[model samples]
Target: MAGEIPRAQPPPAEPDPVRDAHPYVLLWQWRRNPLRRRTDRLRAWIALGLALFVLLAAPAAMYAVGDTVHRHYRSTAEHEARTRDQRPAVLVHDAPRHPEPGSDEARETRYPVEVRFTGPDGAVRTGTTDVEPGLPADSTVLVWVDAAGEITGPPLTADEIRSRTMGWALLAFLGVVLAGLAAHGVAGLVLHRRNLAGWDAAWADTARRWTRAP
Candidate 1:
């Protein structure tokens, strides 16, 4: 008996309290940790609110701005067309003209088919007429020119211009909003990844401390 090695003391019985406990223990532990619990809740709520705001407000804002821009462009185009139609033709002498051949230089008669009007601000404006073969010099003729410098017999109506302008504006607004949403989603993903990394680090730290306890 003296020579025989004493039987190794039975290994200390491992605690079975946690082994039999419900899985809810882990959940309760996590919930009780102030820092971890608060951070998780705050992050969740913040993400939810941001998502809701983007979902609801983005389309509405885009629509409102697009409508405003469309209306503005349409009104401006229509008003300009009307004003051009109403402007009276003026008479001028020695207006530039294309020459015809086989005419005597000394007795050649020149007639005006267009007139130029100088505005009060010294801007020279011109009009042309197709109704008359030639407008006599110092005589008036009526004509209309559109924004693109092409002669127009009838100006565009408000409704016609609005339809086209609204279509273009809405298309552009949609493109912009979609691009913004895409960028926002990418940013959110990056932030979420960083937050996840932080959470993992905190979890590891907590676990290490728990295991090291006396």
Candidate 2:
């Protein structure tokens, strides 16, 4: 018996109280073990912070972004409307009489047509733009232009502004989530590596006694 190898003993069984409880019960580590490591406490605090941010800060950030975008776009729309003018022009030729099935006109409900309009500079300009289908030659159409006789885009409408605001809000929310996830992920990785190193050091010290031969 003196020279024989000792067999490993089974570890004591742990209590199973609340084994089926939800995993998110608050302060679980602190309550379960008074001697929990600093890393564990730090992780708990980080989780609590992230949860609070998701509930309160995320929505606030999204709304702020959306409001800012709406205001900017609205201002731009008002400025453009003030600077630009929509003038009535005569169609040089008729839009396509008919479009093939599933064609651009059929999809968009508009077809390209050539039109002539006089700008504020007293110069006539001819250009092609989309208009509703089935208009005959010499038909009156509206075109937007600046003072320089150059065709320009129409001012943003209410529907477009609302759509853009929603899009920016969604983007802002996603950005917050992505940033939070990245930060938490890095913290978790650092904590994991620290835990591994701690375990290795503990095992190295504890193993000496078991390996020592009497």
Candidate 3:
């Protein structure tokens, strides 16, 4: 029995390097480890704060901004509608079969037609304005005007308001996201630099002690 050789215990299994480095390295703040430093914990909290701001505060801010813009647009549109007037106008003559090459028609796809309408002063007035193409002579079309019968732009419609609201909302969302990303990027850069500086100091101290050893 004394001369019998003891069998060697099975070699310990090798730990996986990748699994040891967890995917969510920031979670190291909560994990107990001798290597986890105070800076690491601070960085983890900063990361958590960034995540909360992106997930929660960003949406809240976007909603607030969108609501404010929507309300303002609605109020302005309502006011414009109240102040502007649309009146029936008749084409005084047939619109030209071919419009000018570089006229508003080319852009808006509407032709300029001569039209006549009664002004607020009760006098007949005539002017040429952009209108739908292919209209016969004396066809009635509604045109926006001011109290002086001067042609003006119509008020924003319900559809326009809705479209504007959506655009503003999208812009607000993008603004928040970009700001959050920028802040996170800057914070990460600063933390990385701090870690590198700490490493340099630690290495210097270790080398100095090694040199001093007899």
Best by TM-score: 2
TM-score of each: 0.37, 0.75, 0.67
For model 2, how many clashes?
A: 0
Off by over 4 Å in 2: 1-27, 100-108
Task: Give the candidate order by descending lDDT.
Answer: 2, 3, 1
Cα lDDT listed for each candidate: 0.55, 0.78, 0.75
- Backbone clashes in each candidate structure, one number apiece? 0, 0, 0
lDDT of 2 by residue, 152-179 (tens): 8899999999999999999999888887
The 10 consecutive residues of candidate 1 with the worst lDDT sum are 6-15
Residue 199's lDDT within candidate 1 is: 58
Off by over 4 Å in 3: 1-26, 90-108, 112-118, 121-128, 134-140, 209-214
> Whose TM-score is higher: candidate 2's or candidate 3's?
2
lDDT by residue (155-182, candidate 1, tens digit) is: 5666766686667666765666575567
Which candidate tops lDDT? 2
Error of 1 at 152 (Å): 7.1
lDDT (Cα, 0-100) at 123 in candidate 3: 85
Pull out the clashing pairs in model 1. none
